[model samples]
Target: MKTTSIRELKHDTTAVMAMVANGESVEIRRRNVPVAVISPIPAKSPIERPNFRGRLKEIYGDALLTVTGTDLISEDRGDR
Candidate 1:
């Protein structure tokens, strides 16, 4: 971690950024009191969409299909 005053940060913006880029956290101070922190942004990971069908199969096997009778669909549609 590195500490920099607000005035120093404003004067040497590039240097502060360089420190952060090297995976160092920076603490910004105002009037000698800490105000904010600057750190490197983490890389994002690939997102995976939820597989509802596979989840249902794992939870209930083949019984999920027939557990809710055909009338459930008709009852849900009636609410609309």
Candidate 2:
């Protein structure tokens, strides 16, 4: 990690970007205090494919078809 003032970052943006691309972390300071950090992009982990139909069948089975919702609220007839 390298500390760089905000002024230097503003003056040479390309150099800072290059450093970041080369796996170097950059610390930007403001008013003589550390403010921000620029680092390399993180890699994402691969996602596993889900068996939707099989999972649903295993979890719900025949109950999925028999389940029903009953409306309990009555409509209020108001005058226009």
Q: Quick one: best TM-score, which candidate?
A: 1
Total colliding residue pairs, candidate 2? 0
Candidate 1 residue-wise lDDT, 1-80, digit = tens:
89999999999999999999999999999998999999999978999899999998999788745546668878778966
Poorly placed runs, candidate 1 (over 4 Å):
46-80
lDDT of each: 0.91, 0.84
Candidate 2 per-residue lDDT, tens place, 1-80, comes to 98899999999999999999898999999987999999999867889899998998899886645333332222233332
Taking all chains together, each candidate's TM-score versus the true structure is 0.55, 0.53
Which 10-residue window of candidate 2 scores lowest in summed lDDT? Answer: 71-80
> Which 10 successive residues of model 1 have the least lDDT summed?
63-72
TM-score of 1: 0.55
